[model samples]
Target: MDSTRILIGASSAPRDGWLHLDHGATSEVDRRPSTDPSTESVPTGRTQRVEAKGELDRADAASVRVALAEWRRWMAPGGELRFDLPDAGAALAALLDPASSPSACDGAETALRARADGALWTAARIERELESAGFDGSRVRVDGGRLVARAFVATSTSPSNSGMATDPTSSAPDGAARDESNTAPSAASHTAPTVDAPTRVLVWCGGGERERLRDLLATYGRVLTNRSDLELLCVFDGRATTAAAFTEAAGAAFAATLGTAHGLRLGCVALPEDAAGLEALRAAAAIRIAIHDEPLQLACLDLAGHVDPARLARAIGGGITEPANGALDDELVRAASDLHPWFYPVELAGHRVVPGLGSPCTPQYLESRTAHRRQMLVDAVLERVDMRGRRLLDLACNCAYWTSAWARAGASELFGLEGRPEHVAQARLHWSSNDFLPEGAWRFEQGDIANAADWKTIRDHGPFDVTLCAGILYHVRNYEEILRWAVQQTREVLVVDTRVQDGDEVLIDEPGDLRFNAIESTRRKVVPNRARLIAVLEELGLSCEVLDVPFGTALGVDHDDDYAAGRRITIVARKVRSALPSARLGTSSTDLR
Candidate 1:
């Protein structure tokens, strides 16, 4: 049997080692014998690969079905098909864009309307058609205003060959021959052939000094030039007293700083103080900011409150720099003062907090503890999970140290729930000073974990991709409830860091507050044995594993003695096989600090 490689809708001259087919009357490949299954009989199960370009969009629904069926029939077991078609959605979007010229808009409209019988060929529609045509799996994505798709024929012999063509002569769309030695393509490569750049939406509220705004814009403009994928949307609060003036000043600042280079990717809007308007803005925004104005900060918070907590994760409270006059108001000054000292020494804007009078531990101790715990979590759990676009929940998030760390690590949305209002304020201050995330992508809420009502509020914000119950489980009297809540809220993984007893018995100490007292009430500490903790987590449908602690000397710094003695352990619990996808359970190693 001859191995066939077919290229349909070839607009150019045919290359060696492949068969080319086209229906165009003036095409160079028109001289070849017709392989149209409808008109002429073609051998089935002989083709190793098939690539079609610009043919599907010109076919009606019935014709598309027939063509797909014929192509799949021709494909051998473990064969593949790749194709590209005009993206109807992209065409429509191009027509809708106000920046598009009249001629360009007309051309897009004409191309879309010219489709066979006014039929539209979208990526999603093509995927469905491919699936119906008996392909084992199919994927479609928009690329340069066109839909590129790949489909595979299923094989029952070996799982390795399930979605890969065996023939060595099979070539990619770019005419490169396939390497027969390579393993099957990864699921991600097939499912998400193209990875679109993540958009960072920046919502700036309240006007600043024109010079200050210009300086800020100048800094951002330089950053934007290098990051074409990042978009900047400056939404000035229309409710502010200086709304019109601020807007005008901002426009001038943008022009002076960025000029025409970033005009297409940057936009400034002044939205009215209506709920509908705010809601619309929130729907499109990934971050929100209020700069140097306490009233504006409060207003931004109020606006953020209306959004679903799960959706409103990232927010910035103030501008990056402190005011020159040094006459900061009460709330701003207090938040900046580190009113509720952070248990972990969180560094923001190149400044690390010094251990103040009420600090529980020395700066060295805090740094060592934070580094050790963070390294353990990353190696045992975080490395396994894809944090790029995942939602994260940080319980008892004092000063949001872990929350801020995860945000920088690439968690798209972050919700840090802490019992202390002062810590929440400090968390806001930390983000404001750093200006690391876009506003509306992170939020620090004050909520008591022990309260069921607070749990209800947290539930509304979930189900989270990852939940961190660090240093709080052992502190709370209701350890079981906390575990259950953490497990219930988490969809993929739950990380617990707590003091564990060496003995089998679960011990409950007398009501006491630790040196780093962030809890509101003096609750008895419930320390469970390692086995009990693992068993409970297993019962909650999680596969739990204790993370290994680095040797005392290997830690590079003096960490707490409890970790070296195995009294304090970090447990990474992932949902059982039945609960999560098998792919997510794959073991991966990450470097330790």
Candidate 2:
């Protein structure tokens, strides 16, 4: 039996059968450690394992990736690698607790202090790093107050050193090597269901392999013994599962459609051959599935809507068959079908199998009017507020379009407050889909901004450097009061984007002019003219200026060439800390507000 060669960092020792490479020089270990591409620490094609217990937090992303790549190169056909670090949230809790040991608390404080200093790791970041470093079957968990991750080398010859190795031709029992060829598990497609219907089983197999595929599925049916009632929805890849094939397979048991001409029909696979077909299934599928021989893409669209990270971690830890809770697979198709038409189409992992939650802000078809507004907001902030390392507040963050923009621009910390739970979920979904902010840098909390208690919760998180009150000012009746609170909370800049009342005469306490809502509600409370907004900011000891962008950049009651029909404006207000040499507005030494 070959012994496991281990590359352990730090003085903390492990159990027997492990080799610890603890060089006396700490500087060499700190700079290179496990990720030296040229270092031939171990013999070629020899299986090696690594265990970095509580040390990853000390290393940078580039170093970590290099270490993992080196490990992959050294790993034989079936080698394993694992690492663990203190969870940032758990570390903070430990730091705040009086019962924790002084040393433990010190360690926790150090990790969090590094996080505060802009060095941190998120689950998403970890996953991306591992994948980019050539590791497959990546599993991450926040267990027992620590972040643990395990992965294996993925190559053409040896796809994974973990999980049941799958092969198309063989019925390899428990330990037999199997082929995980085209299948890459991607269940993260978070969109509200637009239609409710029964579950459909989509199968894609070649012409000659239809019978073999049926046999293979029968084996799967036995595995899913209790789930035999699921309706079979078959879509052949190319001419593989042809119409004649369907006629022979089940006769009238399946309805064979040529393509996805009709949007989301019962028991149909919308083949992505044309524009109509692609658009039809873009945001319509309740569930998407592929068989073994075909592309190994399967999305439990039902599970994608509200992903609990803990539960998702458990599901991924367990194989594809095992969900964290037993109830996840119970008639999910029906539940997904009942969802309200998603605000917009959302694509999963950029795959054609399932579309994204396509909403007006991040639309698939149009010119993305939401992107234009976000750019305008970014431009206004970059002009006055120094975004680098600043804390930001995003009020009424519907799907966090502006909040994400701030994080991308280098805001150190971000807090987004949204009234709706669904919108918050969408924001989280977007974060999971993209890498806009580092982990633990931004948080989106569900709360009605109009409520005092919720406002207090937001206040506890602030004294923020910049506050954004865009598209939300006109929704509340107490618009002036909201502006007053915003000025008080913000330390430096307050940006406002909304429709201004027509004419030079300043208007105040005016009712909403039916811009965002078709029917009037408490939400459609007030719309103040541009001058009144500027005056309120000035009264709060902040110098105000109206930032100008191109017309039609934002959506409003009217965005045409005519200014008399009301236009959207972006207002920037900066707290005058000291009198400038030029002495503008509230900052003039002669006046001094």
Candidate 3:
């Protein structure tokens, strides 16, 4: 009932209301009276997220089962329980054979052994135990020497609660109280989300030194010859410049420079004031990089969306001044930080592309977790089929990573389709540029995967030799429809890479057996097991072969049949053959090559 968090573990220092339970106190915890008059009972179907770390590894299976039951009771509907346990194989080896090698019993194992409950814990066993304790969407994976498990506590009623809890104290008891200020805007202009970054950034310099300075910085971005669509707008409020005068001058320059060449709408309006005006502009432009020319106040609107206040404060705390050499280093940094949400978290300047968002997907950020998997998929596809001078279609192509790779592997023509316009723009700016692919070798289009018009466009592009459907099947709701369309579009091979359930039997029309909503994002994603997937592919007049490469194994992850239900699978479905040949489908490395 109180928003205050309650912690129960073996921590030395204890905070207010935190019941720090040790190994000795756990018995008391188990034996405590169910009906306690002193404490207010948590509302039924209230959302509770229980996170247990380190301590679960030291506890026995029975103790864990008891803890799970207690946590489930405390959880409201749609509540989650996450735990981290010691790896059974690694920990047992360390405890039982302590003198064998100290390497086996590392710091975590040795420490946990001191308080060991003597119950070995494997990823699979942990998942089974969690499920037996009445939890849905149980996902357990091994990271390092620890087995991590996460699942939502199963509710008695159907999941119609919308996962929103209602406070009994509030007058409006339908759901939780929301801030009135966050209501939808009265103006239609304020409804649109922030537009993607523009192809070009144009600045109306009131002549002289500022004009030359504009030229220096304009090369860094797409600096539009004419206003196409306003992603970024800069108004010069100089010593003698007015907002009206700046707009007029910029319009004239745009007309004279690249008139009629531009097709997109250019948002060139006077600076806005007030919440509605600011929201309208913020929604329209990725950011309003207001660079002042002294005597100007610093007041930027906080949408509280993706841009963090702390990060923004650190970036724009001090005003940036052009260096003596006229380099816009400081200005660029400020702009980069401001446009961080718009950029694809990667800087593609010259031949080098560096990470901007610092996520695992980019090599500059983390060690590229999917690099090996991607490479394996590419290698597997190339080994079985020859793609030289062939046309290819890449579905759900994120920034044309696979498109470019396929091109390099000898695909003469490529068409990559993505749902996000931002990704399409980035793909055009980086991969499809003249420096990377030849003028007409590859093209990237933005369209919804579920849309028939997008499939028609792909169909118009001609029957592609190989249709690479990777990292996409699981995100979409109507995957069968899309897959059917993809089969109609592919000429020879259809490379399917996605997550599938680890089971011998395929799941079809099994209502209540699988979660209607994905555990991760509540999005409807059906993960078919190997058998179901192969059967579906075969039904579509294609023979399927599962690649030999172990899925998600390189990143110290084991894709075993355990706590985690979904495992990454790469299946090469051939349209020519009705069934996979024995030589091609076998597990031998020689057969794969």
Question: What TM-score, to 2 decimals, does candidate 1 have?
Answer: 0.40
Best by TM-score: 1
**Candidate 1 Cα deviation (angstroms), residue 273:** 74
Estimate, for each residue in 24-112, the C-alpha lDDT of model 1 and write its tens digit: 31233343433332223346898888877776655666777788888888888878998877664455445434466778656555444
How much is the lDDT of residue 310 in candidate 1?
Answer: 15
Q: Could you report the Cα RMSD, in angstroms, for every candidate shown? A: 25.3, 24.9, 25.2
Q: lDDT for each of the candidates?
A: 0.54, 0.47, 0.46
Q: On residues 16-68, what C-alpha lDDT tens digit does candidate 3 reach at each position?
A: 44333333223444211122223333334453664556766556657888877
Clashes of 2: 27
Model 2 lDDT tens row, 1-593: 23355655666554454545454212234322233332324545576576666656676545666667766665665567788755544554453344568897667655434321223443334555666676644555555666677766533231211111111122111221111211111222213334544343344333324333332232122122223223334444444455445434422111111111112222334244554553344344444332222232433334233323332223222212222244443222222212211232332122111111111111111112343454567765676767888898888776566666677778888888877665666566656555777777778898866555567767888889989887776556556666666766788888888766644433223222121221223433555666776776777777877766654422211232112233667778888853223322233222211
- Quote model 3's TM-score: 0.38
Model 2: lDDT to the true structure: 0.47
